[model samples]
Target: MQDLPFDIASLHAAYESGTKPGDVVAECYRRIAASGDPGIFITLIDAEKAHAEAARLGPFDRVAKPLWGVPFAIKDNIDAVDEQTTAGCPAFAYEAAADAFTVAKLRAAGAILIGKTNLDQFATGLVGVRSPYPIPKNALDPEIVPGGSSSGSAVAVARGLVSFALGTDTAGSGRVPAALNNIVGLKPTVGALSASGLVPACRTVDTISVFALTVEDAYRAFQSAAGHDPADAFSKAVTTPDLGTAPPHPTIGVPDTASLEFFGDAVQAASYAAALDTLRSEGGEIVEFDFTPFYRVAEMLYGGVWVAERHAVVGPLMDTAPEAVHPVIRRIVGAATKFSATDTFNSLYRMEALRRTCEAAMAGIDLLCVPTIPTFFTVADLEADPIGPNTKLGTYTNFVNLLGLCGIAVPTGTRSDGRPASVTLLARAGQDSLTAALASRLHRKARVTLGATGWALPEIPEPAPTLGPDEIVVAAVGAHMSGLPLNGELIRLGGRFIATASSAPGYRLYRLTGGPPFRPGLMRDATGGAIDLELWALPLASFGAFMAGIPAPLGIGTVTLADGGTVNGFICESAGLEGATDITEFGGWRAYLAAATDRQGAVP
Candidate 1:
């Protein structure tokens, strides 16, 4: 039992063969001891308590409890009933009154809590060493700095001390650690998971992220943990779609040559080039775009009004016990005081302009792919120049939440010098399933072992069909897609998303002239290019009411899928072409709509 890998599938296999939950729980502690990394945890649940919880799980019924008997940990900033919520500041520590919303959800799914991991003070740093405690060693290479503020969480999962752990991402805290530690980091849509029990760093953009050995494990944890919490004003019911196949020939956007930054690491640059080649080989159409807007947005995260949000949470602590805060964190969060209320509004205005520019840059791209961290930083290097190295670490990650994007950072392969290499796939919020599916394919292609465990990558089964027997398949290519404005209508009508499917080579996508919620016009044309669309299973009973809501220039028509299958979907009449802008270059309505989120509206 101690020799068994703790991946959900392998653990479940052992359980089926009569392995006991308490034994698995005990083995986790044994491995933690074997690891000899005190920096990995801030507080651990008692071994006896863990065993008791494992024993209380009773029968191994994975159907009712998907995470049954699985061991996991959370960042100290996150609350667990009776555990101390330190937020990495000893002076600010207090006992948690209840389990965090996500913790409760995971516990409900039958996962056993093992401990609270260490992190950057108040989740403030990208380099994890800001903690009052000892910094976690990078799981892959001890010489490298463990990425932060989720350092301990990432290392714990990387070293296989636990199957998965939860970390918080405000400005790259979640992803930077995974890239450094050779693990999968899932930064979910900001509102997808409830934030009721999480200590705020930058409340507007903060999200609790997952660190796991594989994309499958990470996404599975996401499904069990995601839910709409009415108590949390920021929470939203973002759909957790099945990890269906990625669209063939996806239009992937990458940083243009002028925008590529490696800080003089030729090996990192070469590895990224190799990864791009792999994507091309996998049938993705690589399009290069200016990354200047994104880089500016990343700059805004730390250098803009958002810093004031961090100040809001820790100001009182700083006033009462300034010495308790990490010096690096205090300096960074303290800068917020220089700005006035008017300065904040000024930054917000500038932010809107930047967002519009970025949205326009991403107008036609399916998803953006970038190096998880531009280059590596050694512990010695960070110690020599704390601020420079930490600022450099957020090169690719700091812009995500401010832009309302969902991202997953997955290990691609090893670099030339044997350091871990990773890339993050990002899309508009609520499009997590698409990124995960693509990430899964990319991970499988890399053939990398799971974290520091060196356990071979396991096969992830294809997702089951989304349609029910009584449901009729209806295709959507416009705002009706997930996370878009019209998606609510589908949910109200019992529409279940099946998968994102590509159309045959005879369709043209257009942005139809419309109101605040702009709509798309997908039309079949002999000379048109292939486009992407969503498949939804609508009840046969509700089909009539759904069709009745269709306006002029749009009506139900037979749409041809890349697989040669046909389904009822939206089609624009030729008359609609009079005022519509051709958006076929963007490939799909969702891509077109991504820019529409800007205040100036859809700038195709």
Candidate 2:
């Protein structure tokens, strides 16, 4: 077999060391030819054209460009100038005059565009076989469906054809295929990536997604491709931080086991159970919650008003040339003609009610965990019941975009039957980094090789963990340190230890007039104040719980640390200082205790 574990970073390193880009381009073609999988690509870029593009880069320049010399493929639904985009429908093929917004971004970042890969016709199906084009066989097992419409893109990455590929997801096009192929798929928030120049799926909810072997590579590709585009009306110039690791003990919301639907695939059901065990092994807490509201929201996609959006895009073409669309696609899109405007409005109202229920259901969680797909299906199964199994596969995926959440699919392990098993971590918009962090750890825990490739897992430097946006750092001056009674509140809420440091010099501590548990108040003074404090990272999910436990004048607020970093710490309001006796001479809480012990000269 041709090399199964190729990545962009490695290729760039080889190019910088002296290998020619043309040589690597030749290797890509050689691999494509050797794979004997004609279903992988709808239209490949001519080898000669690829070499010409590779030759333009004089030398590898990682500083000026990140993806320099990297090779990648785009789903045919996305346009690439000079390449014909069939979108899995040869009769509807068109030669793109210019690259899609995502393609233009990748080219600017110095990534080589290999070609357009196959997909379900019009980006309509979750099963890979929905197209007239040959179905890209599952990378792990040829017996199973490839999982579409990002089917080819996922398989190419899994087979080491490219380091990463772009796939558009309206429902689960980006995630489903990644799960099927045993790779990482990052579906960013709707407006996170610019969708200009791409064919519309559900125009309002469409996003270009990333498929790569590792979470780091996927994130790197996302950062390069994502940014506000003035050309795209849907694009937003929102602030986004680079991906970071999550603090230990993340609050992961899990669907109630009874709510999970595996459709009688016992192997898949067992795989999911093992995945939850894997999460527990990593120090994550799984909070069980009802998933009915989410399921109701998902139903709206096929049964509600959104199906009309597909009709809106292809309805005209269907009217003009119904024969051109695939028979199944034709039947589905034609159903839109039956719904009147009144039906659309009724769906809109029902969806709003469902959304509220979902919001309440998701009240206090940092991330939601779900099987990437409910189960696996084979090409024969698809042939037997094309629509049924396809819908079942999307049980956990269909409602994500409708609820406005970001998700990343990461392979966890292989089932006993040898098929891949995966899980997706979800977060609210702007929490992409949190999901990436948790997903990467889960990927490593699976201990699986990269997709179908035999490549050993690369040694990735562990990312420094940080608190999420909702989290606030707290300073504990008294008994609330690690391993203490009060510390349990913080730990239960997904808090992690950050650093052990002292406060700035201008602080005074006083033993408050309290009993049973004992309490202390910290006051700021220009002349004298010395209080020792330990910093603990607190996630937003449990910040309120910690705050409510505080008694009297001591409250949570920002405090400057010895390193000049500010975090939410203990602060005393002015009124509490009246009856308190000053103990400013001691530099810290530990020092004050030391003095008291020395003065008494015996253990109490």
Candidate 3:
């Protein structure tokens, strides 16, 4: 039992084999004791207490509780009823009166709390060593610094102490640690998880994050925890797409050569390059874009009023007991005093502009992929220069939340120096599933062991999330495809990408004569070819509005997939083909467009 892998799939296998949940809980405690890492937990739940929680989970019903009897931890900053949330500042510790919104949801899903993990003081630093308590030693290498401020949570997952754990991300708290520790870190869209019970660290952008051994596990934990909370002003209701395979040919945006930053780590740079190759091998079209605007947004995190947001949470403590706060945190948060309300407003305006600029760079790109951490930092390196290395660690991560983007950090491969290679897949807010889907593919491609455990990565199937009563699935054939011109119309109506598929044979595609944005029309014919198309789920309420916008010659009709499954999609009237040119040999509109551009030397 001690040797059983802590991954959800493996653990559930043990459960199906009649292994008692209580014994599994006991084994988690045993693993904790054997880990020799006291710094990992700020508050360890009693073994018997945890067992009681597991015991309460009645007979196996994964349907009622997807996380049944699964053991996990939360960062010390998040509230769990009766537990103290210290935010890594001992003087600021207080017992939580209630479970956080996410906590209650996870518990309701049958996940048992193992303990509360350590973090940087006031959640102010990225290096994970700012706590008054002992810093968690990096699970991969003791000489390296554990990433923070979600340090212990990441370390705990990396060490296989738990199946998954909750952390928080404002800058790179959730993701950087996952990279350093070689695990999957899911930094959800801000407000996707409520902030009501969390100790604030830039409250406006802070999100409860999840760390797990695999993308599927992290996503499952996220699904269990995420819900709209009316109590949290920042919370927004966003739809989470089902976990399916990524688009068949996604346009992946990467940093241009001049904008790529590795901080002199050749191995890290090479690892990132290799990861891009893996993405390409997996059928992604890599598009290089200017990453400079993103860097400008990152600078605003600590350079402006965002620091003031962190200070807002700890200002009173700093005023009353300056000596009680960690010196590093005091220095970081204290600097917030320099900004006036005017400075705050100006910074806000600047951030908006930078966000827009960065968004432009992401135009026509399905997703962006970047190295999770620019380079590695050692414990000794932090001791020599505490703030510099932490700042460098945020080089790729700080801009994400500021720009309202969601990302997941997944281990790609091992660097030449034996350190982990990780890259984060980022997409616009509410698109967490798309990033996770690609990250999962990338992780599987690497074939690396899970964290420091050496357990083989589990082979898991796509989780088929049951669609809600208010939802409807639609197939998109041309401009409505993701990253295409008219795709935003679908998104504005809450359309979420599901998967890419090919239309059933005998449906010929043609470039219908039209104006402004050229559109494609699919017509049933005797010798038509299978054309590429994307499946998207939209709200049933908005389906009428989408349907109302369909122009002449293009109307929604039942289109059969190559697999024989049918979906409602754009179909053309036979009369609409009068002036159309058949492009069936191109297979898809995107292919035909590419050929047209190559021949005509301009976009169609």
What's the number of clashes in each of the models?
0, 4, 0
Model 1 poorest ten-residue lDDT run: 595-604
C-alpha RMSD of each candidate structure in angstroms: 7.2, 6.8, 2.3
User: Compared with the true structure, what per-residue lDDT tens digits does model 3 show for residues 79-100?
Assistant: 9898888988888989999999
With a 3 Å backbone cut-off (N, CA, C), the pairs that clash in candidate 3 are none
Best by TM-score: 3
* Cα displacement (Å) at residue 480, model 3: 3.1
Order the numbered candidates by lDDT, best leading: 3, 1, 2
Local distance difference test, per candidate? 0.88, 0.80, 0.90
Query: Per-residue CA lDDT of candidate 2, range 174-222, in tens?
Result: 9999999999999998888898878888888888999999888898889
Arranged by TM-score with the best first, the candidates are: 3, 1, 2
Candidate 3 residues lying further than 4 Å off, grouped into runs, are 463-466, 482-493, 499-506, 514-518, 526-532, 544-551, 561-565, 585-604
Which structure among the candidates has the greatest lDDT? Answer: 3
How does residue 317 of candidate 2 score in lDDT?
79
Q: How do the residues 105-143 of candidate 1 rate in per-residue lDDT, one tens digit apiece? A: 999999999999999999998888889897899988899
Better of 1 and 2 by lDDT: 1
Model 3, residue 307: displacement in angstroms? Answer: 1.1
